[model samples]
Target chain A: MVDIVIPPLGEVEEVRVVRWLHEVGDEVQAGEAVAEVECEKTTFVIEAPVGGRLFAILVPEGRVAAPGEVIGKIAERAGGR
Target chain B: MREVFWIPLGRVGYREVLERQRRLHELRRLNKVPDLVLSLEHNPVITLGRSADPRHILADPLALEAAGVEVVTVERGGDVTYHGPGQLVLYPILNLRGWQRSIKWYIRALEEVMLKVAASYGIQAKRVPSRPGIWVGNEKLGAVGVYVRGWITMHGLALNVDLVPDGFRWIVPCGIHGAGTTSIATLVGREISMAEVSARVRAAFAEVFGVQVRVRDPTGLEVMAR
Candidate 1:
C-alpha cells in the first residue's frame, strides 16, 4: 500500500483536512489529488503517489492533521480497474 | 527586475473576481501569463476561507440578505472575514516555482507590504505573534488568506482603508473573537481616497516582492501585446 501523507507545509504546525476528493475503494491515478488540506495561509491538494484503489482515509474533513501524518492509503493495483 | 502585472477592477463583486482569479491562475500555471496583482474593491460580502468555522459568521442569513451582504465560502486559507467598498482587496496571482516556494515566507512578505503601507499612513500597525495579520494595538488593520495550486497563488490580502468597522460585527473577523477592526481613515482621523491607498499599496507590494509592477488596463495596448 502507498501512504498518502501530509507533506510538510513550511512553518505550519498543523493543517485541517478540508475534504477528501476521492473515497475509499475509488480508483486513483498517480499524482491525482485525493484530499485537500489547509494551512494557516494556503490550501493544498494532497496527491496520490501511485495508481490504485484508495484503500482507507485516516483523516476526515475538518480534522486537524500534522505534517508527515499519513492521511490515506492506496492499495497497489494488480490489473485494470 | 522581475515584473508583476497589475490589473485594476474598480468595484467588483466577490464571485466575479474569484472566477477571474481562477482563470488567471490557470493561465499563470501554464506560463501563458506573468505574475499578476489584481486590486479592486468588493461589494459588502463575508467570505469564509477553506478551514473557516461557520460559527464565526454571526449575522443572521435573512438579515444579511436584506442588507445586501453575501456570504461566500472560498478556497483560500484562514477563517471568516469581511470585504466591502473602502477596503482594498488584492489578489496576487503568483507562481512560486522560481520565486519563494515557502508559504510562510510568502505570507510574511504580504504582511510586510501591509505594514509598510500602514506606516506610510502614520498608523502603527504591527504583527501579533502567532497571528497572521496586521494589527494596531488590539484592533486588526489587515487580513490575509491565500490559495496555492501547483505553487501558483491566488486570494491574497485585504487592507482596511476607509471602511466602517461596524459591518465587521457580522462576523468574527478571522475567527478571532473580540478582535476589533480598524482602518486608515479611523486612525488618521480623516477620509482617504481608495485611489490614494491603492497607489500606496501597489508601491509597497512591488517593493516587498521585489517586482516591478507594470500597471495595465485589461484591454490596453500594453496588455493586448502580451
Candidate 2:
C-alpha cells in the first residue's frame, strides 16, 4: 500500500483540491496525474507515485488539502495491474 | 540578475493566446527559449478556472453567445473571471526552477508588480488579508490565475486598465459578491493609454521580480494571452 499526499507548494500553507482525475478502484499508472490542486497562483496536477489501483480518496473536490496530508491511498501493483 | 524577454503582443483573442502559451511552455521546459514575459490585451471572453463554480456565471448561455463572447474552461487556478479589450494582461513564462519555487512567493511578486504600478499612478493598491490579487480600496484592480507545468508558469494576472466593468456583471467576478471591479482609468478619473500602462507594468515587473526587461521581437508568431 502507498499513500498519495499533497506535494509542498512553496510558501503556500494549503491548497484546494480542484478535482480528482482518478477515483477509488480506478487503475492509475505511475507518473499519471491523479488529482489537481490549486495554490495561490496556479492549479497543478499531482501525479501518481506508483502504478496501482486507487484504494481510497481522503480529499474530494473543493476541499482544502495541507501539504504532506495524505489525499488518497493506492495499492501498488506488481509487474502490471 | 537574469533578464526576462519582454514580448509585447499587442491585442489578440484569448484562445489564440492560450495556444501560444502552451507552445512557449513546451519550449521553456526544454530550455529552447529564455524566460519570457508576454504583455498584451485580450478580446472579450469569460474563462472558468479549475475550481470555478458554474453558478458564478450569471449570464444566460444564449445571451452570452449572441454577444459574441466566448466562454472557455481553462486549467488555471481561481474562479470565474472576465477579460476584454482595454485590460492589460501579463503572462510570464518563467522557469522558477532555481528561484523560490513557492507558489505563494510567485503570486505575491506578481501582485507587488501591479501594486507598484498602481502606486506610481498615485493609486493606493494593496493585497487584502487573504485574497490573492491587488485591490484599490474595496474594489479589485487586478485578478491573478496561473498554471505551472514543471516549474514553468503560464496563464497569469490581468489588471483592469480602461475597460468598462459592465462585462464583469455577466459573471460573479472571482466568486466575490457585492464588491465591484475597478480599473486604473476609473480610479484615476482619466483615460490611461494602454501603451503607458504597459510600460509601467514592465518596469514594475522588473522591480518586483528583480529582473531586467529587455524588449525583443518575439521569435514566433504573435502570441496572445490574458
Candidate 3:
C-alpha cells in the first residue's frame, strides 16, 4: 500500500483539500495528480507516488490537511477482486 | 545561473494574454520550453478569482460597461482586482520544482521583486500580516494572484506604475475595504514611465530569483506556441 500525503510546502504547515481528481476505487498512475489543495491562496496539485488503485480517501474536499498527513491510500495491485 | 525568458507584450487585452499563458503553461508542463516571464500592460479590465465575491464589485454593470471595463473570472487565487494600462503585469510561467517547491516561497519571491522595484523609486513597500500583496503603508502598491497546477505556476503579480483612477474605483481592490491603491507615479509625485518600471522589475526579478533574465522578442514565443 502507498500513502498519499501532502508534500512539504515551504513554511506552510497546512493546506485545504480543494478537490479529488479520482474517486476511491479509481486507478491512478504514478505522478498523476489525484487531488488539488490550496495553501496561502495558491492552489497545488497532489500527485500519486505510485501507480495503483485509489483505495481510500481519508480527507475529502474542503478539509484541511497538514504536511506529511496521509490524505489517502493507494493499493498497488488488484487483489482478489 | 538558471535562465528565464522575459517577453514583453506591450498593451495587450486581458483575454489574449491569458490564452498565451495557457499555451505556455502546456508547453512548460511537457518540458518543451524553459520558464518564461511575460511582462505586459493590460487593457482596462476587472478580474475575479476562484474565491471572489461578486459583491466586491461596487460599480454596477452599466457603469462598468460605460467605462469600457470588462469583468472576467479567472482560475487564479485571491479576490477581485483591476488591471489597466500603466500597470506592469509579470506572469512567470515556472515549474516550482526548479526553484523551491513551495507556493509560499514563490509568492514571497514575487513580492520581493516588487519591493525591490518600489525601493528603487524611494518608496517603502511591505507585506502586511495575513495580506498577500505589496503595500505602501495603508495603500496597495502591487497585487499578486497566482494559479499553480502540478507545481507549475501561471497568473502572477502586477505592479502599479501610473494607474487609471477610474478603473480601481469600480471595485474594492482585492475585496479589501478601506485600503486603496497607489502607484509608483502617485507615491513619487511624478509620472514614472512604464518602461522604466519594467526595467526595474526585470532587474529585481533576476536579483531576487537568482536567474539570468533573457529579454526575448514576443515573436519567438509565437513560434514556440506553434
Candidate 4:
C-alpha cells in the first residue's frame, strides 16, 4: 500500500479537498491528477504519486487537509500486473 | 535571472485568450516552454468562477445581449467579475515548482504586482483581509482570480484602468455589495492610455516576481495555438 500524501503547499498549512476525480478501486497512473484542493481562492490539482488502484479516500470533498497528510492510499499490483 | 516570455495581446476576446492560455499552460506543464505572461484587454465580458453565485449577475440576458457582453463560467477561483476594454488583464502561466508552491503565496504575489502597478501611478492600493483584491479605501481598483492545475497558473489579475461603466453596472463586481469600483484614470482625473498602464504592469510584474521579462510577438504563439 502506498500513501497518497498531500504535498507541501508553501506557507499554506491547510487546503480543502474540492473534489476527487477518481474513486476507490479506480486504476490511476502516476502523474495523473486525482484530486483538487483549494486554498485562499487558488485551486490546485493533486496528482497521483504512483500507478496503482485507488485503495481508499480518507479525505472527502470539502474536507480540509494539511501538508503531508495521508489523504488516500493506492494498492500496488505485484509482478507488474 | 529566470526569463519569462511576455506576450502583449492587444484587445482580444475573452474566450479566445482563455484557449490560448490553456495551450500555453499545457506546454509549460510538459516542460516544453518556460513561464509566460500574457497581457491584454478583453472585449466586454463577465466571468463567473467556480464558487460564483449566479444571482450576483444583476444584468438580465436581454440587457447583456444588447450591450454585447458575453457571460462565461471559468474554472478559476473567486466569484463573478467583469472584464472589458481599458482593463489591463495579466495571465501569467507559471509552474509553481520554479517559484513558491503555496497558493496563498502565489495569490499574495499577484496582489503585490497590482499594488506595485497602482503605486507607480501614484495611486495607493491595498488588500483588504478576507476580500482578495486590490482596493482603494472601499472601492476596488483591481481583482485577482486564478486557476492552478499541476501548479501551472492560469486566469490571473485584472486591473481597472479606464473602465467602461456599463460592465460593472450589470454585476456586483466580485460580489462585493455597495463598494464601487475605481480606475487609474478615475483616480488621476485624466485620460490614461492602455499602453502606459501596460508598461507599468510589465515593470511591476518583473519586479514582484523577480523574473526577467522578454516581450515576444503573439503571431508565433497564435499560430501554435491554431
Candidate 5:
C-alpha cells in the first residue's frame, strides 16, 4: 500500500503535508518519496511504491489534501502492504 | 493546420499518466504536440505487458496496492492492464519513423479506433485478422499496448470504455489467457460515456490518419500547447 497521489494536472488545488519519510519501523525503498506534497503550485516528492515501513499518515502534517487524495501507507518489505 | 488535441486527462494518476507520457515524449522531441497528442486517461493502472511474463502479475503485489491500484512498470508492450475509472487511455505521442516505423501500422490505427467506436454503438466491430484490438462477437473489445522510443510512440490504446467485466478478472488481457476483455458498455447494450468514447476516438484518430481534426484544448492549444 503506497499512495501519495494528486497527479494528472496535479498542480494541487490542495496538498499540504511535508514530512514522514519512513518511521513505523522504517525500511521503504522501491522508489522512495514517502511524503512531501504541497500541490498548490509545486513541492512534490511522493515516492516509495515499495520498500516498506511507514505504516500510515492518511494526511498528517499541516493538512489540506485532495486531488487523487491518498496521503500515505507503506508496510511491505518482504511483500506488499 | 492539423490539430487534434484533447487532453481531458480526467482520471489520471498512473504515475501522472506515466509522467504525462514522458512529457509528451519531450513534446514529440521538441515539435511540441501538434503532429498529434490526443489523450484521455483513467487511472487505476497495473500495466506490465511487453508480451508480459512478470509471473502473470498474479496480484498480491500487496494486494495490488491494498486496492488503490497503481503498479506501473510500463514500456507498453502488453500482458498486464487495469486502467480503471471506465478505462480510456490513448497517447498517440506520434512519429512512427514518419508514420512507417510501423508497429504493424501503429496497430492498425488502433484497430481503426475500435472499429469506429464499435460502430457508434450499433455494435459490429472487427479487426482480429490476427489480433491487436477491436473485436465483437469474439469479445476482446480494445487493448493495444505500445512503445517505441526512437521510433517515438508512447503508450496508447485501451478502450474498454467503462470496464467492470470483473475489472478484467486480473490480468491476461493482450496475452489472452482464456479469452475475455469486451466493452463498449458490454458489446453495445448501453451506458457509454468516456466523453462518448472520447468523441468516437477523436473521429477515429482522424479517420485512420487520412487527417483533418482540429478540435482544441491540449491545455488550450497555442501552437500545439507548448
Candidate 6:
C-alpha cells in the first residue's frame, strides 16, 4: 500500500486544484490519467500509479496542495468468499 | 554518419520525444540493436512530471510562444522544467536491465554521476533526504527526472552546467516554487564549456552505472535508445 505524492519539477511554490478526474470508488490503472491541475495553467494530466480501488479525494477539487503531499491512497480489499 | 551520429533538432519536444522512445521500446522488446544516444539542443521547452499539473507553470504559454519557445507537456515524472539550447539534453535508450532495473536505485546512481561530474569542475553537490536529486546549498545544481518502463529509462536529468539560470525562472523547476537552482559554472564563478560537462557526465555515468561507455552519434541514437 504505497501512497502517491507529488514530485518536484521547476516549481518552488504551491498549486490550486483545478479539477479531479476520478471519484471515490473509481477504479484506476497504473499510468492511467487521473487528475488535472493548473501548474500556473499549463493544464496537464496526472496519472495513477498501481491499479486498485481509489479512495475518495483527500484534497478535493479547487483545493491547493503543496509538493510531496499525499493526494490519495490505494488499499487492497480483504476476503474472498 | 558512419562512425557517429549528430542530430541538431534546433528546438522541438517533451512528450513527443517520449512517444518516439516508446515506438523504439516495442522494437527493443523484440531484441533489436536500439543502442543509441542523443544530445539535443532545444529552443526552450517546458515538461510536466508524472504527478504534476500544467497550472504549476508560472509562465504564460502565449508569452513563451511569443518568445519563439515551444511549450511541451511531457510524460516523465517530476514537475515543470525548462530545456533550451544551452542545456545539453542526453537521452540514453540503453537497457537499464544492463544497469539495475530498480527505478529508485537507478535515480540514485544518476545522482552519483551528476555529483561526480560537478566535482570534476570544482563544484560540490549533494542529494536531499527523502527527496531525490542533486543540490548545491539548497539550490538544485542538477535535476534527475526520468520515465522507466519495464526497467528501460527515458528522459534523463537536467544539469545546469553553463545554462543561464534565469531560463528556469520561467517555470516552477521540478514543481517547487521559489526554490532556486544552481549550475556548475555558477559555482566556480566562471563559464565552463558544454563539451567539458558532457565529457565528465559521460565518464561519470559509465563509472557510476558500471557499463562500457559507447559513444554513438545522433543518427544512431534512434535505434540505439530502442
* Among all candidates shown, the one with the greatest lDDT: 3
Candidate 4: regions farther than 4 A off? A78-81, B221-226
Model 6 lDDT tens row, B1-226: 1121223343346556567666655555455654444556555677766556677778788888787666765556566788875676766555666655445566677788888988887777888874567888779887766654444556677677777535788877777766788777778988788777777777776677666665544456454544
Model 5 chain B worst lDDT run, 10 consecutive residues: B217-226
How do the residues B120-226 of candidate 4 rate in per-residue lDDT, one tens digit apiece?
88998999987888999999999888888778999889999998754888898878799989999999999999898898889888988899999999776645544
RMSD of each: 2.7, 3.2, 2.8, 2.3, 15.6, 7.8
DockQ for all models: 0.64, 0.72, 0.57, 0.64, 0.04, 0.06
Worst 10-residue stretch by lDDT in candidate 3 chain A? Answer: A72-81
- DockQ of candidate 5 is 0.04
TM-score of 5: 0.32
The better-scoring model by TM-score among 2 and 5 is 2
Q: TM-score of model 2's chain A, to 2 decimals?
A: 0.93
TM-score of 1: 0.91
lDDT of 1 by residue, B58-137 (tens): 98999999999999988888888999989998999898775776788888999999999999988879988868889999
Q: What share of the true interface contacts does each candidate keep?
A: 0.72, 0.87, 0.62, 0.72, 0.00, 0.00
- Model 6, position A35: C-alpha lDDT score: 69
- Residues A6-62, candidate 1: write the lDDT tens digits: 876677778888889997899998877788888766787788888899999998897
Name the lDDT of candidate 6.
0.64
**TM-score for all models, in order of appearance:** 0.91, 0.90, 0.89, 0.91, 0.32, 0.68
For candidate 6, what is the TM-score?
Answer: 0.68
Residues B97-170 of candidate 2 have per-residue lDDT tens digits of 75677888889888988898899899999998777899877889998999986778898999999995458989
lDDT (10s digit) by residue, model 3, range B1-226: 8999999899999999999898899899888778999999999999988668999999999988997888998878778999998899999999989999888899999999999999999999999977888999899999898888777899999999998654888899988899999999999999888888888899999999999999999879758756
TM-score of 2: 0.90
Restricting to chain A, the TM-score for each candidate equals 0.91, 0.93, 0.92, 0.92, 0.31, 0.80
Model 1 chain B worst lDDT run, 10 consecutive residues: B217-226
Poorest 10 consecutive residues by lDDT, candidate 4 chain B: B217-226
